[model samples]
Target chain A: MAVCCPLLQHEGERGEEARRFSLVLRAADELCPWVEPVALGSCTLPARGPSRFFGGEARLVDQLGAAVIGALDGAGPVQIGAADGLFAALLAARAGVIVPPGGSATFLSSWSLAVLRRPDLAVTLQRLGIHTLGQFAALPARHVLARFGGEAVLCHRVARAEVGELPGLRDPRIGHRLREVRGELPDVTPQAGFFGGTSAGDLRAAGAVARLQARLGPEAVLTGRLGEGRDPADRGRLVPWGSRPEGRHPGRAACRAPAPWPGRLPPPSPMVVLGDPLAAELVDRAGRPVRVGATGLLSDAPARLSIAGGPWRQVRGWAGPWPASERWWSGRRRRARLQVVDGGGEAVLLAAERGRWWLEGRYD
Target chain B: MFVSTDQGGRAKPDLPAELAARARPVSTAASRLLPLPDALAALFPDGALRRGSTTLVAGSPGGGTTTLALALLSTVSAAGGWCAAVGVADPGVVAAVELGLDLRRVVFVPRPAGAWADATGELLGAVEAVVVRPPGAARPVAARRLAARARERRTALVVLVDHAGGWPFGPDVSLTVRDAEWEGVGEGHGHLQGRLAAVAAAARHPAASPAVHRLWLPSSDGSVAASPVCPASPTRSATTAPATTA
Candidate 1:
């Protein structure tokens, strides 16, 4: 197995340049589904199978180098190596060397003990005068194991290219852990397939909404359903996108009015139902505050009403004065509802309780 | 190395007109016009909602503003088109479903207060049709800008405004519910069922004679059906100004 070691070098490239790197990976995936492709700012591509398909090992390496350089838009210093195992291939790739079959031990022999990646062993090897992999491999396995334990014995075998008995010796996936130090390869995202009619458009729309939700909070995309209630505020309810509508089942109630509450305002629902009722002032022509008596009669006819910064308009016609009181026996609730049209013909729903008035909503 | 920049190089000859025509961009205007409910077919110039155009639907609150708006969106939604409502909190989901809007296909932005215009702009890019109620008082400049954006996006925009007032800016066309009377209710009793409304509409550029029709706006079964045209009242001309509902 031949592994191509792509020189990563620049640390800053992992941030903003990650996108360009992923594009390169995607382009490589399109060319060949390389087994256990590892990306670490730089990438490793095991070239054995692909090398045969592209005509030869040399041709495959050339094509891969071209593809990487193309993806990076001519960024260079892409080095590749071919050998019996990844350990020897990685060492050979650093020197831009390619070792023939059966030459693994000779290829690894010249490398220094530091290439073993166990710094403590490297320091010990240096102190013991075994400065190179060839010299380290010359030491007896039994002596190395008894003195240095199992970890150094394994490193000694890798250094001598005697790794055939080791688990996952030629497996590319073994290098995945090392690749993760920089960053993990993103999972292959699921994509929408071709479908007839507006489904394609719908998927595109859903994608846009998802992106909006990601940028803003989850509440940004909301779904609203009409809920059952006499009060307009309770009538329209919104829930987070994709969730089931809660509260009353809008289909259960025929008129959207709870059965016990009889006098729900008929047709001409307000255009805008104020979440909170706005304070209103209603006075009779004589400048006295108009009040609704206990009998649903006005103590003085309302002459003018003003609400929410809009100019005070003259009252044209009036109806209702019906009781909107809740829990009468508790002594907690008291209010009278009325439908009043201004001189401009804009009708508004008003509730007056204890000489205080509120503009509940306006008819659209 | 000599590079041949021209496509096909010198070796390949231009294809015949019939073959070349296949590569030309096709116009989508005919298919872009969306269907409308049977009752509203006559209101539009093309008898369908045209993409990239704005239509204003104005009526008194509770008088059928929501009903008519839902009716306008029904056909499109039934055809699998996605619809959006901006700055509209509760679209009376019951009324919407009753009037034929598929709830699954609808997206609502309950409180679009400060971001109403921005939200509408975002929805226009994705939805096939959008109904927007201006947050607070309407602004002419913003309305005009949004109208241009709708044209660019090719999304149908239905502006829901109060019939008692005028739109901040003129739309490509306007449909106003002149008067609406609820049926299935008497002086004292009866469950509410449907509405009878007189709708008058005119386009910026007239498609035909002014469209005035009396509609069983979502008749008892929850679908808009045409009713006989009511005689034009003496006090107001349906074509000229907004008619106050009696």
Candidate 2:
């Protein structure tokens, strides 16, 4: 089914670039319908499980070639090469595919010396006049190994179609996201009403409630437990708005209010009991709550410091070129401190030793 | 300085039409003098060397002047255009292999000891782009003739001038490669340690001002990597200014 199409298509009048891309895409698409299409370099179809699914290796490849031709719209002059390694497949593709199951070695053995002219193998092969793949394969494996090392063995393997391994396939479905959450709030009191709208129930019905919860600021929402077990499904969930699950018995249920919800809410209204106050805060060098640090200071050495996970930065503005030298007795105890302003407008002390300077600590 | 206050303002004589035309900014001339890359945008950013135009790439050996020329050749060939390289210093096979050049579309013309210019002239009209490393010096007149032939045929003629030698003819863009430094080796005993230096020096025609740019070459792993080169120094010559459009 596939063979006639690509062979015919290859004969058609199409731009070379477009033709090439389409040919590779169609080949891969047809050969491995189980695996999604992947275009890596010049060839498209790679080694995978589909070869086994279509009954033994030979049948798989014949099918792949046919698929390639079909995808190419029968423009075949399509070359199909299947080997354990990408390099081998590429070489085979360049050299043309082998017929039947075990013909790869014979096909590769007759290949020309020019194939070995790949940059990595060229220089070493040039000395021996081993220009073609056939010549390279004829050389003693041990001698080739001793001279060109492992690469020679690998090349020989490629030439002999004894390719040992296939490259790992990359995950195609990882990190894929499809759902989007949207909501409209009329007032702060009706914050839950927003989620209770059409989209909310639709998302809940789809079992995508977790995704919706993730979309709603997770940190702002608080979870509460119901006092009485009523509706089995709604026993543990209550939103910021004064909305409770409709059930026969009214028990204390888990309740949460998003602090950042858009809309006005009545001040001091008691919809849900607060557990603990949580707010974002910054810490200072001394780990104390202070308004600002002192800026005026005199020191000779320049201060250098860096923010956590940030780039190194130097400080300017000092009162004096004061020089302090210590550690003369111990031979390794020098320390010179300087004061400078940091990004936060805090004056900090920087120390220098053995010529290199550092911001040891900050001042309050 | 005393000015002639001659009120013989019997109205100054009107300038001649030819002089007036010269005085008026020539818009076309300004565009014609744009750098080759800018001029080449009309063709391809990675365009085929213009047919019949002589492009000069002059630099010291190992300064990537030849590499740049070969890269251009590769690009053209990859585009399915036919090309030929004549009078190259390195062996044709080795050069093709090193540059990853497609030899199928290329005709390698070995550098005949004394017949480089003649060989290039012979192949110029037949190929889409011809890279020639002419033997000895090419006279400006001969270069001009070649350039004229190139222009007439619309064939791209890339002339690799050895070292800092001057071009035989005024090139549409004569790019000169200057100061180059070798990137040092990494610690340990890896033979793949030494790569070409990162910096490249270039002077474009029309603007003859020299510029030093950091070059990133393709690596074995097929990753693009960067190397720093010496910064460019300001031009000293005041006579040449960049071509300005009216």
lDDT of each: 0.63, 0.41
Best by lDDT: 1
Candidate 1 global TM-score: 0.50
Residues A1-364, candidate 1, lDDT per residue (tens digit)? 3334344433241232433455456556665676343444444556667877888878877777677667676544556676766677666666766677788898888888877767898898899888998999889999999999998898888877877233333445324423222223101111111112224456545655554444454465665455545665565555555332233443233224334345566544554556578888887888687888887788877788888656778875566676767666898878787777666545567888778888877653
lDDT of 2 by residue, B60-91 (tens): 55454555565556544433344666666332
DockQ of each: 0.11, 0.01
Task: Kindly list the per-residue Cα lDDT of model 2 for residues A267-339, writing each as its tens digit.
Answer: 1111111122112112223333212212322222334345433553444333221234333477665443333
How displaced is residue A160 in candidate 1, in Å?
A: 42
TM-score values for chain B across all models = 0.78, 0.62
Fraction of the reference Cα-Cα interface contacts (below 8 Å) that each candidate reproduces: 0.19, 0.00
Worst 10 residues of 2 chain B by lDDT: B185-194
**Model 1 ranges off by over 4 Å:** A1-205, A214-221, A240-244, A247-261, A327-331, B1-31, B57-71, B74-80, B88-104, B110-117, B133-154, B160-172, B176-200, B204-207, B211-231, B234-246
